[model samples]
Every structure is written in C-alpha cells, then in structure tokens.
Target: MLTRLLACTIAFAAPLAALAQTPPQVSPAVEASAPLEARIGELAQILAGKGDYDAYFAPAFRSQIPKEKFAQINAQIAATAGPMIRIESITPRTPWVADVTIGFRDAIGTVRISVAATEPHQVDGLLFSGLTPRVADMGSVRAAIAALPGRTGFALARLADGAPQMLLADHGDTPLAIGSAFKLVILAELVRAVNAGERRWGDMVTLDGGPLPGGQYMNVPAGTKVTLRELAQKMISISDNSATDILLKHLGRDRVEAMLAVVGIADPKGMTPFPGTLEIFKLKGVPGLADRYLALDPAGRRQFLDGEVARTPIAAISPTLFRDGKPVRIEQLEWFATPTDLIRVMDWLRRNSAAGPGAEVRAILGLNPGIPQPAAAKWKWAGYKGGSEPGVMHMTLLLEGKDGSWYALSSSWNNPAAPVEDVRFAGLVGRAAELAAPQP
Candidate 1:
C-alpha cells in the first residue's frame, strides 16, 4: 500500500491507437467557415499519416514542437484510433479561438486550435486536449474488463450525500490485493486528524528516517523539515511510500487503524496493525520471514514487525527477491481491500473534502488525476490513486460528473503467475468513466 505508482494511466502517458482499428465511413460536416475546415484537414492528414509537418504548422509552433515528434504521436494515435472518421462539431469562440470535435474509429476527442491571421493561416495553437474511447454501451465496458487476465474486481457507483448506488459491477464484493491504493485510508485518517484539530496541516516534520532519499528534501538538508501538507500531497499524488510511512508513523498506528471503520472497511482486523511499505518489503524481502510472520495472530505479527523485522538491516535483505520480476508472497504479504471498500473510502473522501482542512485532500488526489483529458474534463473534478506490484494492480477514481452527480470506480486485478496488464485495465476504467458519466 505504500509503493509509488507503478504505471501511469496510458492515456496521460501518450496518444494510443490499434493497428486493427480501421476508419469508419462518415463525412465531415463543417458548420463554421473555411478557417476551421483547413485546420481540420491538416490535423486529419497528420492522423491519416499523410501530413507534411514542417510546411503546414506555423513557424513558431513548429519551433517548439518538432515535425518528427508530432508525426510520431499522430502515427501512434492513428495506429490505434484509425483515421479521423467524422467531424462531430466545430464551434468558434473568437476570431482566433475555436474547438473541433474529431472522431476516430475507436476514440473521439476535441482539439482546440488557435489560428494565425497571416497568409497560409499556418496554425499556431493545436492540441488534442481530451480523448476518450468510444464504447457502444455498458456491455463493451464490462467485456473489456472481463477480458483481462487473472482475477478481477470492479465497481462503478453513483455517490451523492448517501451510500453509493452501484450502477455496474463484476465481482465487486471480493477482497483482493490492493497495492498502493491503500494510501487512501492513510490520507483519510490524516484528513480526520486535521479536521478534528488534533493536528495542523502546517505542522513541520523533521526527517529522522526516510526509506529512500530524493537527493535530499526542501533544499535545506538531508532530513530537513517538511510540512504535513507537502507529505500528504506526495503520499497521495505520487503514492510516495516514504512520505506514507512518515505520515503513518506520525499519525500513530492505532489512530490510523481506527479510521478504517469510518471509511467502511468490512473486515478491519484483516488489515490490523497495518504495515508500511518498508515493513511489507522487509517481511517479504527478508528470507524465511514471510512464513514466520504469516503463522502469527495480529498481536504476534505486530510484535514480530516491531522486533525482528525492524532490527534487520536493509542490507540483510536479498535484492534478488525483487529482481525476479514476479509476484513474491503477494497474496499473503501485501495490503488488502475490496472494490466496495475502495468506493466507500473514496466516498468519505469526496464528502469530507468539500471544505475545512480536508479541502486540500481534493487537490492532492487531483494532482495526478490518472484520468486523461476529455474524459477527465467531463467531470468537474477527477481524483484518483492507482496501485500496482508484480501480480497486483488497482485503480480507484472519485469523479464529480455533470449536474453535480458524483461517482467512484474502483478495480483490482491479481495474477500470481504473471504480471497483470496495466494498460488494458487503464482502458477499462476510461471506458467505464465515459459510460458512467451523463452524456453531453
């Protein structure tokens, strides 16, 4: 639960498309004047793999974004999305600003362009601001998720003041290995503490011990002072394990565990004496330790963690344990949660984060939204935290959809024999978000 993000959502990483994708038969309908038409044609050419990058775009724009780079991005998107199939709409905001909705075989996006007034009207500002997969219906969303390898659990629910209303779910109640997504609980406890006036967000924490060094912190010194705000942000946004451990230690294990009920975890005792990332690493990384720890009751396990696990030097752990690139004692050693638990935790976050000290929680979760644009844009706010390790992957989203409709989608995929496919899972959540949201 304490590791940094293993993989970012693919949409935010880069444009994606499939070779199997083929252009659909449809014609463009240009409601605006010729300026948009010309811009759309050039953009289509790029996606269609026929554009001369240097001659078409403005000199200033090309200077910043090289022809080869743009060409490659277009090629990748085209390869997956196929050629531009249709123009959904074109709206002019000003003489120079306009939005163009372009559709591809499997995806659709709105690119906003800024055109220059001079001859050739060589476009100046161009960006595919948001792109979302085109799912025919909820069946496509479910099928995409079910097609993945290993055990999978997913839940999509509408959240508004009361308990979450499930829209669609597959194996939503089953408990599975949820990696860093467990950080949500840690964040929730921190929010609770800050809200109750037990602690202040601006409190300074000095680094007595940090799992890894980031070349040092805050430009002051190695173990320098950092704010709770900074730690909370890093812990959630980047899933920073070091920050997580620090906050967990600062918050007290019992205090943090107490909030588990507040967040609606069904079996709080299952995760009793919650272990930090370093603790989990030591339990699994140290030879002959997992079995020893697994044999104990919660009290015995907590004692073992504080005693032998804490005393063992980091050097004593075998590097090869993690080097094999396979799941290592994941089912027995890692953090645990169910899809419903994740949604409930997220719902608590959404409801509490509306004001007070919890407000920053919203911004922190939105820091690395995990959702790509257009789909991300559909929601007023998109807060996300994803987790992964060999044989384990999880994604949790808190979305504020149109008309003040709020929702959460959480999923977990675990396969001990091999690495779970993260990109496919990312696409599943993306399509689910598109389907969950009220269409424009």
Candidate 2:
C-alpha cells in the first residue's frame, strides 16, 4: 500500500519537475503595473464594452474623482455604451464600499455594480438616468377651495424638473360658457384679418344714431369714427356692449363663431343676434311701473327700469324679466360656463399676447400692459371683463400679486333666475379670486 501511494506521489511530482525544467515562454512586450486609478480606468472601459456601464471602479479610484466631474464621466459612459448603458444610481454604500448598478436595454438585461476598498475613495451604486424625486399631490388646492359655499373647479400648472407639470385641478377638463371672455376670439380674428391684409388697425367704423338708445346699441356718440383696434380695446377692457356689437357686426357673427371653434370653445352661439338686446332696452324704457309692481326702488337703474314710466308695461314685463332664470326674449343669455372652461380662455389669451405683431390682441378696456395693479392690500392687479344678463353674471380675470405669480380666474353664476342682489352670486367669484390670488 505504501509503495502504491509513493508511486502516485511520484507521478504528481514528475509534472512539477518538468515545469521547473522547461524554460518559461517570454513575449517581446513588457508593461509595468499601473496606478489604481489607471487600473480603474482600464476596468471601466472593459465593463463598458461588456454592456456594464455601472461597473466603475470603487475605493481608491472613486476618491480621485470630484463630485462635479462625475456628471461628465457619466455622460462619457453613456456615449460609449451605445444607448444600452442606462445609468440608474451612483452612491456610496459604506465608508469603504462603492456600488454601481448598470442597466442594459439589450438582451443582457441588468447588472449591479459594487466596488469596495479598505480605505476611502469608492463609488458604489446603480448607474442610470431618471432618478429625480416627484411628489404627486393635488389635494391641497382642492381642500382650500372646498371650504367655500359654492362649487368651482380650477387648474394649475408650472415647470418642475425640466418639464411642464400639472399640480392642481378638480374637474378641470369640463367646458363652460366663459361669457365676454369670448371677445378674445374677436381680437384674434382681427389680428388674423390684419395679417391677411383684409383689414388694418386704423380701419374705422362710423357710429350711427340708429344703433344707440333706446340703448339698443352701445352709448357711443353719433358720427364717432372709432378704429377697429379701439373697438376691440373697449370691447375687452370695459366689456363695452356697443364696441362689441360694432366689431361683431363688422366681423360678422358667423366668422367669429368659426374662429372660436378653431380655438376649441364649445358652442359658440353667443355672438349671434338675439331678442334680449332689444328686449332689455324696451324693458329699460318703462319706469315707475316696473319698480311699483316688482316692489323695488327705481332711482339708480336707469338702464334697467325708468323711474318715470307708468305701471301697465311694468306689470306686463315683470313676469317675462323674472321667469325661471331664463329670460323669455334671449335664451342664449341663459348660457353660462364652468370655471375650468374659463382657464382655457385665459390660456388662449396668454398665447395670443405672446404672438408677434399684427397678431397682438391689445387690451382696450381694463388695465393696460404697464398699469399698476390696484392698491388694496389683498388685491393686486385685477384685469377683467364682466358679463351680466339678469341671473347670469360672468367674470374673467388675469390676477397678479406681490409674489409675482399670476393666476387666470374665470367664474360665472348660472342662476339667471336667482336674484343678482343675492350678492353671494358675485361673492362666489370674488371668493374664488381671493383664494386663488397670491397674498400681498
């Protein structure tokens, strides 16, 4: 047994003897060992070739790289990896450990990167892009608004992490009437007309006595030659009824409706002729009669009810004026909108303001471009247009504050049958603006 064991040992020793006896093969090229950093760089290239971009060296190599230079190195890795080396994360695992996780888009799939050192200077993490933090919370804006007595919807958006982000909303996609805010469509069309050479800003419309009081047309002086631009200004800024009617007449209701359709406002029927404009005037002509029968004072509302007229026409008109939130003469006046729909109009107007010359929609009625905002501590700049037809009161505003943030507010009360004296109707919109506008 001993001899057999000896024989086995001899067999194993014979190969060692041959290895010692044989001369070692030598190559013509001889390279010295490189520093750790140089070795890490070499390893990075190898891993990059192997579809492991996160395979960067940890420890001593990581200590050599500055934080600012890391981005450049990461970019270089991506370039070398041909789109497969998606960087996930690069972070320290421990004082002595560095980890890199690499992601490959191709067949090789994913790999984790880990490098450790006895001392400092190590990078350890998964290397890839898309690692920014995001918080998806929109409840705050809603909670703030829900405190109010009425229902209103809103939308908010801002830049976050290099992209447009929607931060708040409630039924924000639904469309509504948007009232005089539709005038912005007229402004846009006028700009288009100027661009097409069909009309110029200086083009004039002669105001005639036939269009005014009886208050059927706006109360402009007879023979007033207002420019198209001036008409647009008054129409939007002060919500002037006469200026709007002239522009509406000159531009044609059908053309304006078509342009509104292009901007995606639903049901562009407000511009069309309706009996309400004339009916309201007829009703306004009646005086003490309307007040006596309606049980109201008649001193202030010269446009609504004349104080001197007899009672017979007042009795005849009161039912028609106060019916079911819907006036008998003009059904379209019953048209009102949602808050979200108003945002769309404001966004459209902002886009219009950003357009180039001949495309500018200049303000005519409200605050001019450079006008200072109101001085009220709570109220800043309130550039707005208001529409009131009985139970319906609509307001659109571009509100800015001391904080330099701007909010576009669109609000309408649909209770045309509800009393305007309810005050809450207007207060609803005011409350919305108060909540939305930034504090002084």
Candidate No. with top lDDT:
1
Against the hidden reference, what TM-scores do the models get?
0.72, 0.46
Q: Please, what are the lDDT tens digits per residue for candidate 1 over residues 1-440?
A: 11212122111222221101111223354244476567766777766657777667889988656777677657545644667888887767555556677888877766667677777877887765445567777788787677777788989999987899988789998888888888888899989988888878899998775343121231234567889999888777666666777788888888888989999898886578798776777777678888899999999998998888888766555656544457787778877889999999999998888898888888788876665455676777778887877778788999987678788999888888886644456655766776678754
Clashing pairs in 1: 17-80, 17-81, 18-79, 18-80
lDDT of 2: 0.41
lDDT tens digits, residue span 50-150, model 2: 42333344544344333433544344334323344444433333322222333443211122223343333233432221111111222432453344333
Tell me the whole-model lDDT of each prediction, alpha carbons only: 0.72, 0.41
Q: Ten-residue segment with the worst summed lDDT in candidate 1?
A: 15-24
TM-score for candidate 1, please give it.
0.72
lDDT of 1: 0.72
